[model samples]
Target: MRETIQKVGGRLAGMVIPNIGAFIAWGLITALVIPPGWLAELGIIGAETADTLTGNLVGPMLKYLLPVLIAYTGGKMVHGHRGGVLGAIAVFGVIGGAAFELSSGAAGDPPQFLGAMVIGPLAGWVMKQIDDFLEPRTPAGFEMLYNNFSQGFAGLGLTFVGYWVIGPVMSAVATAFGNMVEGITDAGLLPLADIPIEVGKVLFLNNAINHGVLTPLGTAEVAEAGKSIYFMLESNPGPGLGLLLAYWFAGSGLAKLSAPGAAIVHFFGGIHEVYFPYVLMNPVMIVAMWAGGISADIVFVATDAGLVGPPAPGSIFAYLPLLPSGGGAAGVLIGIAVGAAASFFVGSILLRMFPVKDMKDTDADADIGDALEHIPGISTV
Candidate 1:
């Protein structure tokens, strides 16, 4: 079961890692150009410039480009370039279906990322199966005709399925998940959310959860509240920082030696993925993450802390500009501090009790990247 989960996670990570650059570009553009963003707030760009860039670049990239990229990657994973092309073609139907649903008065405009992930691989597999059956039956002079027509027809059917079925289903699923989170917040049990979130982050569902689920809900909340705690839930760097700090101080050999660099990336650079391998290496350390996340969320609820926008990359630097002014800023800082301290204390104890065992026959001086390659289902990206 663990191996299976890791394989699934590795695939998911595979699709997203290649696209991290695009996500970062979109995030940076949004953070710098949106109203209350860094450039506008700093008086470096006027409101008009910010608005134009946002309207022309940010919204389309989020709505169209990102999901298509994900679908293309996923399809490529299943059946090479042909599968990728089909996947990209099919995802348009999903996007259109979602837009149609929204036009009927849906409360939120959730990005079709989840829909893309589902349809991309499905489209690839369908094309692969079609080729497997059709190739053997095609006549000697009809190879090109068989190949082109098979994929074209399959893509057309898949697109219709995506529009009529997959899109509506995925949108409903997104809505349901959002409503569930909203219910938790309404009941004053937002911290309880960390149970699934911390566990999911380690399993490499962090991006799917954050971008597919949380961001849409958080965006809706921001429309009413000017900020939303939903953005902080998965992206908070405190727990990962504390975990890496514990590893730095208490772990052994390669894991210990690599901790400081990973901590810097996870906390300051806002690449939270750098710390996931540590948790993967030491599954028990997830408890420390849970403790940290829940503890921080408690503070967030008490202080009503939130950011003006989602902090992409989730680094301390990404967080700085998004921080609300005055007490909210202090609250965000305090919560992060508390989370880190709590995670560090608990993680330290766990490492002392269950230190990461060095791999048998591995060199003591092996490079961290080389050592990571030996771990099953770990992605160093």
Candidate 2:
């Protein structure tokens, strides 16, 4: 069951990972162009310029460009170029249907990422199956006609299916998920979400959860509110930083020697995966991670902290540009600090109680690299 989940999660991660650049571009633009965004807040751009960019770039990119790119990538994953084309075609129907549904009085205008994830692969698979059946039966002289017409017909039918079926279904799913998050937030239980998130990061499902799940949900929240706590939920670098600091101060041998560099990368660079090996070497350290994540999240909720866009690398630098205007910056920094401190404190205790005995440098490095390679779209030099 674990293997099955990982495989599915890996595929989903694959679809999103390739398009991270697009996500980052959109994020950067949103951060700079929205009212009171960095540019306007800093007096670099006037309100008129900010408003113009928001309408021309931010709104359209979030609503159209991102989802289409996701669908195209997902379709390509299933059945190559042909599948990708159909997937792109089908996603438009989902986008249109969703727009129509939301215009009727829905409170928020959520992106159709969920619909794209579903229909892109579905359209691709359907196209592949059609090609498989038709290829064997086609006569030698009319291959082009058969290939072209079959895909055209399939795309047409799939677009309708996307509009009438998948779009509404996925929209409902997104809304349900959104409501669940809101309920958790309302009850002040948002910190509890860190448990699964911290565990998943250790298991190499970090990208799947952050990019595939949290990002879409966060984007929806951003549509309603200027910023979203959902964006900070999984991407916060504090817990990982705390864990590495513990290893640096409390660990022995290579683990100790390596901890400083790892901490630097994990915290400032925002590549949280660097610390996973430390936790895996001593699973007890996960308790520390949970403690840190939960502590920081509590502070986040209390302060009403959020980011205007998803921080792609989960780094401190990536976060700076997205900080909401006003007093949100203080809350964001405090939460990160709290998380790091808590994790470090707990992680130190865990290391003292259960030390990672020294292993050969090559063995430790290989083990870490091998573990990382199991995650989708990651490879170590």
Candidate 3:
């Protein structure tokens, strides 16, 4: 069971890890377009242009670019370029608006990204299976046409299946997940909610939790409330930042060397993956992360610290623009400070108990392609 989970997580992480830049780009655009944000408040551009950028430009970027890129990556990981094309084609159905009805009677438009993750691999695997069967049967000169058209037709068929079938299933699941989170928030149990989030993250499930579940819910809340703490709940960098900073100052060898860069990227660039390897190197640090995460949630909940919009990449700079005007800015700052402090304090203690040791390269530190290379017939090329 453990190996199965790790394998699945590895595959899912592979899909999102390479696309971190797209997430950052979306964050930049989101920060500029939202009112009272960097571009709007700085007076660098008029409101109309910002709105146009958000609607005409940024909207498509998120709807098409990120999801297709994720699909492409997953497909490529499974069966190379042919799988990639089919995966991207299948994702169009999920991106299409009002194409299906949800179980709750809601019209499903702009399907959850979780659906993209599922359909992409499915399309890719199907293509791979077909390719395996056709390899020996195809005539030499007709190979190109046979392969291309087969994938093209398969992609087309999967697109419709994705739209009418997978989209609805994801909708119901996402809706249920959103309702659970909202219920916890309504009951003031958000701090406790951090436990599962922190655990899932360290287990290589961050993409599923963030893009799959939180993105849909956060986007909805932003549209309605102008801001949501839900976005901050899982994406806050404070906990991870604290751990990395502690590792930098009081650690040894590779961990110490990598800690500073990881902290910078996580806090400023909003690339959370930079810190994952650190935690995976020493699982005990997860307790520190959980401590910091819960503390941050406490402060955020107590002060009602909320952003005016979702911070897509969760960078400090990206986070700033989304803060609601007035007291919200201060609350956010304080919450992060407390969170980081708690994490650092706890993480430092852990470091002292089990000092970082010099170690040779191993699967724990290897990239997905390298780590999975042992599996037969599954070429990452």
List TM-scores for all candidates, in order.
0.72, 0.63, 0.72
The regions of model 1 sitting more than 4 angstroms off are 99-106, 195-231, 240-289, 302-315, 322-325, 341-381
How far is 134's C-alpha from truth in model 2 (Å)?
1.0
Question: What does candidate 2 score on TM?
Answer: 0.63
Q: How well is each residue in 249-300 modelled by candidate 1, as lDDT tens digits? A: 8887666766786687578767675677677656778899999999999998
Give the root-mean-square deviation of each candidate in angstroms: 6.3, 8.4, 6.4
Give the 10-residue window scoring lowest on summed lDDT in candidate 1.
359-368
Question: lDDT of each structure?
Answer: 0.75, 0.74, 0.70
What value of lDDT does candidate 1 attain over all alpha carbons? 0.75
Q: Which pairs of residues collide in candidate 2? A: none
For model 2, how does the per-residue alpha-carbon lDDT over 24-123 read when each residue is reduced to its tens digit? 5776676566765668888999999999999999889877897898789778877989999999999988887753222213344456766777788888
| Candidate numbers sorted by lDDT from highest down | 1, 2, 3
* Candidate 3 structure quality by residue, lDDT tens digits, 1-381: 534444455456556655655666675676667554577778998888888878876678766887898787767767889998899998887666213332333333442455667878888899999999998899989988998899988988988987788776755554554444445655668897777677656543454456545566667776886767777888898998999998987777555765676588789877675666566556677788889989999898888787766575677887876788756677788888888898899999998996644433334323354533333433343
- The Cα RMSD of model 2 versus the native structure comes to 8.4
